[model samples]
Target: MFDHIADAVKLPDLVRIGDNLVVARFETMKVYSALAAVEHLLNTGAVQPGDTLMDSSSGTYAYSLALACHKYGMKCHIVCSTKADPSVVTQLELLGATVEQVPIPPGPMVDKMDLEVRLQRINEILAARRDVYWMQQYHNGFHYHGYREVAALIDREMPGAPLTVVGGVGSGASTGGLATYLRELRPDVELVGIQPYESVTFGSEPVEDPVASISGIGSPVYFANVTYELYDRIHWIAHDQAVAATLALYRDHGIFGGMSSGCCYLAAEWEARQNPDRQFLFIGADTGHRYMSSVYTKHDQAVSLTGLEPRGIRELTELELPWAVMDWNRRPYEVAPKVLPC
Candidate 1:
């Protein structure tokens, strides 16, 4: 019975963009990882049937966890951000998960502050409910293990080639986990992590009450699982760049992917131009359906596509792009986890 949802997480389609680049479209990648993590807990007896599963998510992970809990006959509770798509919240309820939506933080949409408040609220819920088991996606090692197969699948598909894996850095499970496994197979593999402009992940100067338009990637606070050593380079993509790329992707490739995926695509394109000899693989985190209201619908379609044109893409690098880029090795802050009250 567990295999029903567990089996669905394998082998996202690999779509070739041109000669040197490919986008690995994992339509439900987070859902797949969530199922894998939950199955591990169940199989190892870490969690028993009917235990309530609790976690905090911006949006994608909440839906994934809700689906996993539903499949396994467990009750689910989520501390979700108010930024989450209304559709996702509705679906979570439909799947029978209880939800607590945290209001967006005052001042700005600083993801770190928003996340910190969400985590604090999550702990408050956990403190009151001794029976619930927190999935702890941000701190859980099991979350990292779930994406090992994604790395293996990519390695199997492209053998003996120097590869650059590019993707948005979120909880760090998806990109961090994939890089961890891939590096085991090919030590020479390059990793490029992308985050939003104001994200603390890449050591960018903090904006005063900055609001982030993109979700599911970038954090105002550091996640314990985001392995800094695995990255060869890191790039920060801004809201406008992400939006422009997203519109371009839909117009050019017919791929309806979200802002994070757009960020990955733009990074991949830049990397591909730089290393024409190497194969660049970008992980498309999720589809664009959830972004219609926030991203697609709000923009003038023709204007958005036009904004992407003048960048003279082939000549652009991290410096020329709308966002900033930094070598991860030079980051001033230590990538260690901060002690938090659980």
Candidate 2:
């Protein structure tokens, strides 16, 4: 019975954004990946039944890990950012997982330093326990393998068309792994990566991104999973741009996706316009229900969509599009593994 619930997590609803754009809304994609990781460890005898599974997540992955532990009768301890959604935190606790919420430092954007602080807390927890296994999402290649099924679904659903896969680059498992698998079948399929304005993923000079209302899409630190070569191009979407696109998606398509989804949607929209014949596919990482308080309820629906007048959907591509564009070959940041204490 629990196995069925675990299995159901992988299948997400695919929705159309426009004529040439589609979003694979992974309302619980992280759950699928997290469960896969834990099961792999258990089956391989890498971890025992009573052992605790630990990791740091912003929100979605924390819920995923907690659910996985609950299904498998294992202990789960999560070190998450204070920015994590309250609803997600409540769910994690209700699932019987212990959570430690680390306070984020005052900054316009979340950066490597913030992640380092979280890592410090996680390390502290790990140091206290001998039977804990860290499902390091950013560096774990196992995380990449879980997404092969996602690529298969995309291929099975949309076969035989020039395709461009686009998504926000977080752990690189979702976007990088999907692109890697898809390319194995169709080498010509284009891969585009999206990040927030302050993210260094595409080598944009780090700045305080006051507008980054979303988490999970952009990283302050360089992660090993984000293979720079896997992408054809990268675009940096601003916080306001993401917010505008997110609200527009809800109003126009009735798709209530998170900010990262909006960022990918905006990029996919641009890519679709550039190549009308090709299908632009992007990942809707999660739903916006968790963001209702800060994102939806706080803003005026009418003004949120129309306030950015000159920079509205009409000028999305021309003006409000990528703050910076980088070809994969010419990216500024060195793609190397971050040396962490964990």
TM-score of each: 0.87, 0.87
**What is the C-alpha lDDT profile of model 2 across 182-289, one tens digit per residue?**
888787788888877555555443345664424687666667777777887777767776777888777778888888888787777777887998988988888898
**Candidate 1 local accuracy as lDDT?**
0.76
Candidate 1 lDDT over 110-203, as tens digits, reads 4556677888887787789877899988778788877888888899998766999988888888988888899898887888888775555654
Residue 171, candidate 1: Cα error in Å is: 0.9
lDDT of each: 0.76, 0.75
Worst 10 residues of 1 by lDDT: 309-318
User: Which stretches of model 2 miss by more than 4 angstroms?
Assistant: 104-113, 301-322, 329-342
Model 1 regions lying over 4 Å from their true place = 1-6, 9-11, 108-113, 205-213, 301-321, 329-342
